[model samples]
Target: MTTIRMVGFDADDTLWRSEDYFAAAQSTFESIVGAYVGDDARTTERLYAIEKANLAVFGYGVKGMALSMVEAAIEITESRISSSDLQRIVQMAKEMLRHPVDLLPGVREAVEQVAADYPVVLVTKGDLFHQEAKVRDSGLSHLFRRIEIVSEKDVPTYRRLLEEFAIPPEGFVMVGNSLRSDIAPVLELGGWGVHVPYHLTWEHERQADIPADAARRLRSLTHADELPGALRAIAAG
Candidate 1:
């Protein structure tokens, strides 16, 4: 097998704290909505339903979720929610957007180790502006040869990226947390994938369906500290 010529990294969760904040916001949203509904257990499910449906219209990110939350709050409460609560939902999103980018343990060392031997690209998704801002704030942007803030991380998107990098699927390994966005797509394209899980994940990303036959191309790690060694193993194969 060809050695890895380019390494693709996902920014959110893999490099820094992300989902947990969103989870916190979601909890707050539920509490806000709960004051009206009184422990309606399906509140989050309803919110997730709206978010899933709105994915195409709003795309992924805090802004999208904000819109969905507002919509869900209005619909879930039958428009009985107060304007103040609605504003609070909006404020939650702003807080998330302004949330500091906290890099995970050893993330910088891992990226630097890999970049020293291979061209590394940061392929991440979210609202373009927010994603760009987070990447800039993360202070690790200088290590990447290229930064791609994409709308989605699916098969076609990865295919296009590999083509732009002039590397074949067999010679690239995608590293990140989301099984659906980061690992599944790359594995589907005959590339190697490493899943370094975060403590929390969005419900949508948790639904990743990697091909059963691609098991040999997939690796899972508990932390970023294991990344360089995993890449070396993939290369040796």
Candidate 2:
């Protein structure tokens, strides 16, 4: 019989504070862009549109968001935005990139506890340099058997990772904050999921649709402390 021999974790939000910073940067962005455009709602919408459209090109992380912000600012203001404000936008991204990694409460202990019984892998997607720095800074790197910094989290990616591990999809569990990225795809591939919802999520992540049957294989936990119990429950079933 197949069992949950390996567990995967998503880095942002799930393990640490991420989107909160992004939200703040967006507010900063809105303020910078707001000077030229009076409509806050329109400004935010336009920026998001640009960011989403640029995902394939810029990919994900502070640099991508920074570039998209610069583009959005220019387009929203019709090139009326001054160089000073543009510099401020660049400063915002700089602050984010340099920001320290603050892991969530109980996450370190939770990962340690889970790793005691099963092998764990970090399945995160973002800028390679940023993710590498975060993993090195996390202090929890030694707990993971493998660290996957992916471009995107989808069926194909997960399948490849599982193949590399030589484990079947049904014998794995993915723990994360985004249902779209962490939970749904793994569940679709017959893996179990433990969802630890963060207080803040990106607009793009919030829009992902999980399949109707995903809930049956998913365990939603509010805090990191509850992860081990959820995994035990899955293991028992």
Candidate 3:
């Protein structure tokens, strides 16, 4: 096995607890929508379906989520929500954005240790503005050698990063929380991947099937504190 030289990490769930805040906000938005649309199982199901469908079209971001909430509310209420209600939903979205950012357990120490020996890069996908804001606010920005805000993570993105860094796949590793976005693509490109699962992952990011190749390359971890030792083992292999 080759010594890993570059370590790429997914930002949202790997380094911090992000999605739960959004989930809470979503729940609040749903409740507001329920008031206008009539509280019931049918309305809840319809709103969830509409929100899920809109996610495919809008992608993940604060603004996209806000739009989805608005659209779902309109759809369920038959366009009858008052301007105040719409404003309230928008305010809720802003509040979600403003939720306190907390680092995942041991993430800071792990990154600090990893950066001492290898190039650490933050690779994440989302609205550029929102993602950048989080990155800047997290204060982990300085620890990374580079930051890539991608629209998606796939084989092409992984390959492109390897090429740009002039590094072989065997010399690179990706650390992230999402199996679909972070682990699978890195393994597909013959690199290594470490998965650090968060409490809440976006529904779309969940994977029903884990490819054998990905599974072979996968190292599931409970927290970022385990990363330094894990990377050492990978390098030794």
Candidate 4:
């Protein structure tokens, strides 16, 4: 019989509406840049372009995103911005850090159900401080038995985590929003994965398609509300 001993969940979009806050902050940054550049459309486009181009250089995280906003503001304003404008942009970035964490639909109920039967762990990748802060604020933190904030999610990361936890691949399940970071790597490590697609995934984490083999290895749910049922089915199988 296949028994699930540990269930690992991805943070961010998997459990909550994370990107919306970032999107709001980006819009605010673009507006600030627009005020200085004189052409709103052109300024917004240029700022977005700069943000896309800088992904490889800065990666993800609040500090990096804040820096990107600052750089974009400077670039779009042609380095002519007043001190007050620069300070507003910095203030907007700081406001993003204070955005209230809100869970996605069904996330809390799903976690509660799963926590009743199995040990749950949150496996997320981001800057340590930012990620830990979100986790602590989420109110769902107590449901998890362990938390991992990693720089990357790969086969090696999954393997080491499984070994450290004394969790066999067959007895573990990975539930997340990213096919690339959460599903594929865990599937490669011989664990099952449950994919709950998010409406807006960070561009870097997007995958071309779900591989057939990986798809076959997974049990998917359209919403977190369906998670408990999926887990029960996995157990029944």
* Candidate 3 per-residue C-alpha lDDT over 1-237 given as tens digits, one digit per residue, 9 for 90 to 100: 668889998999788778887788878877787776555747556655766777667766777878877887787778888899999988987876776668887989999999998999999988887888889988899999999998778889889989999989878899998988998888878889898888888776888366775676778899788999999888878
Q: TM-score of each candidate? A: 0.98, 0.97, 0.92, 0.85
Least lDDT summed over 10 consecutive residues: which range in candidate 2? 206-215
Give lDDT tens digits, candidate 4, residues 62-178.
767777778877777778877888888778767777777888988999999999999999999876888888999999999999999987788899999999999999888999999
Residue 74: error of model 3 in Å?
Answer: 0.3
Best by lDDT: 1
Q: Which residue runs of candidate 4 sit more than 4 Å off their true CA positions?
A: 36-59
Which of 3 and 4 is the better model by TM-score? Answer: 3
Among all windows of 10 consecutive residues in model 4, the one with the lowest summed lDDT is 39-48
**Given candidate 4, what's the lDDT at residue 220?**
73
As for candidate 4, its clashing pairs are none
After superposition, the stretches of candidate 3 with alpha carbons farther than 4 Å from their true spots are 39-57
lDDT of 1 by residue, 179-228 (tens): 99999999999999999999898989998777779988999999898998
Report lDDT (CA) for all predictions: 0.93, 0.91, 0.83, 0.83
Residue 193 Cα positional deviation in candidate 2, in Å, after optimal superposition: 0.7
Per-residue error at 8 for model 2, in Å?
A: 0.3
Residues 139-179 of candidate 2 have per-residue lDDT tens digits of 99999999999999999999999999999988999999998
